[model samples]
Target: MSLHEQLYQWTASQGLDATSARRLRALSGVDDPPGDPWTPLRRGAGALAAGLIGFGLILWVAANWDDFGRAMRFGLLQAALAISLIAAAALRPWRAPLALAAFLTLGGLLAFFGQTYQTGADPWQLFALWAALGLPIAWASRSDLAWTPWALVVATGIGLWMETFGGHSWRFDASTVPVHAIGFVAYGLLCAGLALRPGAASQPWAWRLAVLASVIAISGTALGGLIARDVAPQFYLGLGVMGVGLVLAWRHSEVYAMSALALSVDTLLVVGLARWMSKERLDVGGYFLIALVACGLLAGSVTLILGRLRDAEARA
Candidate 1:
């Protein structure tokens, strides 16, 4: 039986008066009101409306590009931004839609300024500034709808900045491996920090995106090593990611946190098979036997992790 049911039964068995029993039930939440099913639908509708408004504004500006003077264009964007912010303030408790609209308009304003002025600034600098400027609106709204896209924009800006000004190129060769590997670690750590930030539990997408980004970064380094035929680095990188997954799964008890573990396990299996096939030069029959064994191990590990994931999902 559920905890509420058990509590109700125990309270009744104690021969308590009806009023006292009811009070006990209410205090224990056994008599809680039913949840409103329309809440999620309302939230979804608000988000859709916000998106449509933003898109329509963009299209309108594009269609009137040639007819509008520079002052008119800038004035229109500024007025839109001002109106959205005011609406957000007036809405108070129901502010997410207007807040999101304000941020989207902010992006358009930045884009317009960039196109018109030709600032000669790096792309990342613009994005970084945009994200930085949007922070107040996001925090003020206190909605994942605001923060999720904001976080992604910031991540993009940081990634590009690292690529351009951080003295690195996208080559998987030996000369670039160390630099890229370090970059990946740095990026992964930043994502992890976001994932572990306070209040992230309510904004699950924030943490999930962070975890996915971190896994991708670590996987890139591992794949780079594999492509370079450096088995040692490949193996170690996979191991490290797997270890991190274990810690997150164990401590945080999050279902999505185990993705890196599963990925690393698969990578190790592939790397092991490739190494055996290349170095040992095994006969066809031996290769088949090893493949079967490896597949079996992979299947077992997957089943175990899936079981743990289910438990985590339930607990979460």
Candidate 2:
């Protein structure tokens, strides 16, 4: 009937003598026995863990130091970063720290170069160093758990590079600024996959990053129109912008879809205005009207298709 009676009956059912049962009851009294929990097994495990982490970090630094003198070892955080990257690639356990290490190293390398330019000291070496760090940053981000930060940095790098190219002349000897700006756009697309991970972290930072990336990507296109004079006489730049927006709409939601729709509408209105402007006597208004109608039909068709799919699933 009562918990104590129930426990007594249970102990009696075990065929314990009265004295043995009473001793067992006393052992399980209100407080459990307190003692040091560090058995030989637990002590050995903690020691091993500490040793492995320390050893791995030490070896990682040793592998990446360049052929520089004692005066420069303090600055070899680059090499230290390289060491982290090397460990991430070679050791599966190091993947967890790969993102943090890669970001710090790449950003430090960038700052080092940017600083030289600012200091009016060793600009050539700065450029050379920046170039050298690029390879490892790319490689480091490719590993597990490190991809998101990698992608974000690459996107920002591209944006910075794009903004730089739009201003400078003969930015690169091989080609023009447009060539380098394209790298930024390409990097943004490649890193979009990293956006998916933040949803798992439950931290709003990941989603914030995704929104930031989209803004960066959109800005690059606007910058494209400024540097490159490559639009068709018969076509409009907004068409290209709208097309990009639609591609984004198909991939993700939020502001991207709305932006795409708004841009598409704006392009149509521009096409109409071009007709009034009279483009070689072509019917711009008619063409734009036709495109607008076509887009509306496509949207209705998609709705119908998705509705049917939902209905079928519900029946099942």
Candidate 2 lDDT, 1-316, residue by residue in tens: 8756766887879988888777557655623576667654553453355346545654665675555454464456567667766765776644445544654566565665565457653333343344345545534444323344544555555555544554533232223434443654454454344444434333334334544565445443433333343422112333354456555644443343445344444445454454444535657776676677667655764564455545544453
Cα RMSD (Å) between model 2 and the true structure? Answer: 17.2
lDDT of all predictions, in order shown?
0.72, 0.49
lDDT of 1 by residue, 170-283 (tens): 444445545555555655665676666557667778656656665665565566556564554644654566676767675665556665556565666676666656776678
- For lDDT, the strongest prediction is 1
TM-score of model 1 vs. true structure: 0.74
Screening candidate 2 with a backbone cut-off below 3 angstroms (N, C-alpha, C), the clashing residue pairs are none
TM-score of each: 0.74, 0.39
Pull out the clashing pairs in model 1.
Answer: none
